[model samples]
Each structure stands twice: as C-alpha cells, then as structure tokens.
Target: MPLGDEPVSFTTMVRGREIRYDRDAINAYLGRLFTLPHGEELCAFQKQLSRGNWDIPLMTRTLLRRNGGFEYSAAQNPLRVLRDEMATFTQLLLLLVLHNIQPCSHT
Candidate 1:
C-alpha cells in the first residue's frame, strides 16, 4: 500500500465475522473531517467514543483520517502516525499528573 492509494474495496475476517469496507467512502469522510476545525473534530470524536457507538472499521476510518491537529502527513502508515500521537499524549498526561503531584521548584 502507498500513501493516498488504498484499495477502493477490501474485505477481511474478524472474529469469525466477515467485514467489508469501501475505501472510497472512507476517503470521502476523511476529506470532510479534515475540513473541520481541529477542536471541533476532536470534540466530535470524543463524544462518539463516549457514546460507545463506534466499530473497528469506523474507528479505522477516523484514525486514518486524523493528522493530530496538523497538516495531513501523507504517511504510508497513518495508523502508526496516530499511535505516535497517542504516545505523545500519554506522555503529556503523565507529566501533567506528576506536575500536579510534585510541583517543580525554580532553580
């Protein structure tokens, strides 16, 4: 697979269930997502996740569509890029927690 060149249609088996997704629709949705403001997109996604109204394919589409509130990188592995963003967020969260618990003193 190459950047911006996903299969138009694909199928796979998951947990004994067959799944199919149209990459065209995913791409269209991604295009629309990118048009929205950064905060708006994330708020919408968070709301959806809280409602537990998402599936693997839907999540996949959303993750692939996201670019961490920055310009789309056109990376070969969008998922990996998303994972890296998640790691950064996790680290930031840890730092926040530690800061709150143990404030740093000025040198």
Candidate 2:
C-alpha cells in the first residue's frame, strides 16, 4: 500500500473484460502536476474548495484528464475493485485521490 507500489495481482470471476493499469499514466499525471504552471492553478483551486466556495468552472476543468479522458468514480471496495469490467485508470486515480484525502491507517 506504499506510494508507487503496484498491485501484486488482480483477479476476477468474469471473462471478456479489458482492464489496463499503466504505471506510466500515473507518473505522467504527477509529473505534469508538479512540473507545469498548472500546479499553481491546482493549489489555488484546492484552496478555493477548502474555503467552502464552489467554483463550477474550475470543477469542470478538473474533471478532464490531460489525455482528454473524463474522470469518473470507480468502486473502491475490495469486492468491486476485483471486478474485471471496471476502468483501471479511473480505479487507480480514485485510489490515489482517496489515499491523499483519507487519514493514515493505524494498523
């Protein structure tokens, strides 16, 4: 569960499903967020949200990935995470986001 650690394996009960988890995709996202002028924008946006003020325009822009893919929620529960039909990219992103937002586990 450490940062940058990849899942050891994935299992599913169904067949004929496509699941892709490209580590490069995640690294690319982080790289862009850290290296570009957009980082300031991101920080400012997060600050605005933290202040309880909603920015509809910024929310719309934040939902799209750099590759032009739209962001969507993926189930994080172990049972649903094991499903073969889920989009791997969204699942990974959700995991990363949740990790950032959630408190550290004591166990």
Candidate 3:
C-alpha cells in the first residue's frame, strides 16, 4: 500500500507495498482507445453493460455473429470487463511506482 492525497491511495506497511492514484495516466489510455473509429460508440455500449442495464448475452451474441464466432465465457468476460473499468486505478499505482512516489523513511 502507498500513502497519498487520495483516500484510496495507501501503502500497506506489512508488505511494504504501495498503491497510488494517477488520473492522468488513465485518461491517456482512454484517449488512445477513443481515437479509434467507432471507439466512442463501443465505449458507451460498454458503460451500459457495466451498469447491468443491458443484456450481456444479447450483446455477446450479436458481437459473435458480427465479428466471427469468437465469444468470451462469463467468468472471463466479467474479469476482463472489471480490468478495463479499473484501468485507471491500476495505471495510477503503476505511474506512482514509475515516478518513485514512495514515502520518505525516518531513521
């Protein structure tokens, strides 16, 4: 865990692990994805699915039919979807580490 401005950011003393938040990094990744043609539309659709208001089965079936027979299992799909949603959180920690945003030690 890591300690920082964000309440969600903290450093786990027991494991000496750090966790940080970097919104910029996440936005960058989203920007890259949004730059692709029809990316924004896909993103909106994903958001609807995230809200649990859309039928994932119907969406998956349509995607499979349109984009070949490739299909993701329920278990795999949820995890993948979660990872995508948490991309910002993950990038924040990664950026913190890359920038050496560690707490100072008092000896």
lDDT of 1 by residue, 11-86 (tens): 5669998676555556675675334575464567788867755464454444443444223346722223333543
Better of 1 and 3 by TM-score: 3
As for model 2, its CA RMSD to the true structure in angstroms is 17.7
Question: Backbone clashes per model, in order?
Answer: 0, 0, 9
In model 3, what is the error at residue 92, expressed in angstroms?
A: 33
lDDT of 2: 0.49
Report the Cα lDDT for residue 5, model 2. 78
Report the lDDT of model 2 for residue 97: 71
- Model 2, residue 19: C-alpha shift (Å): 48
User: In candidate 2, which residue ranges exceed 4 Å CA deviation?
Assistant: 1-50, 64-91, 99-104
Worst 10 residues of 2 by lDDT: 76-85
- By TM-score, how accurate is candidate 2? 0.23
Top lDDT prediction, candidate number: 1
* Winner of 1 and 2 under lDDT: 1
Candidate no. 1 TM-score? 0.17
- Which portions of model 3 show Cα errors greater than 4 Å? 1-7, 10-19, 25-43, 60-107
Candidate 2: residue pairs that collide: none
Candidate models: Cα lDDT each: 0.53, 0.49, 0.49
RMSD of each: 17.8, 17.7, 14.7
Which digits, one per residue and each the tens of the lDDT, describe model 2 over residues 14-49? Answer: 577644335554556567533437436356668775
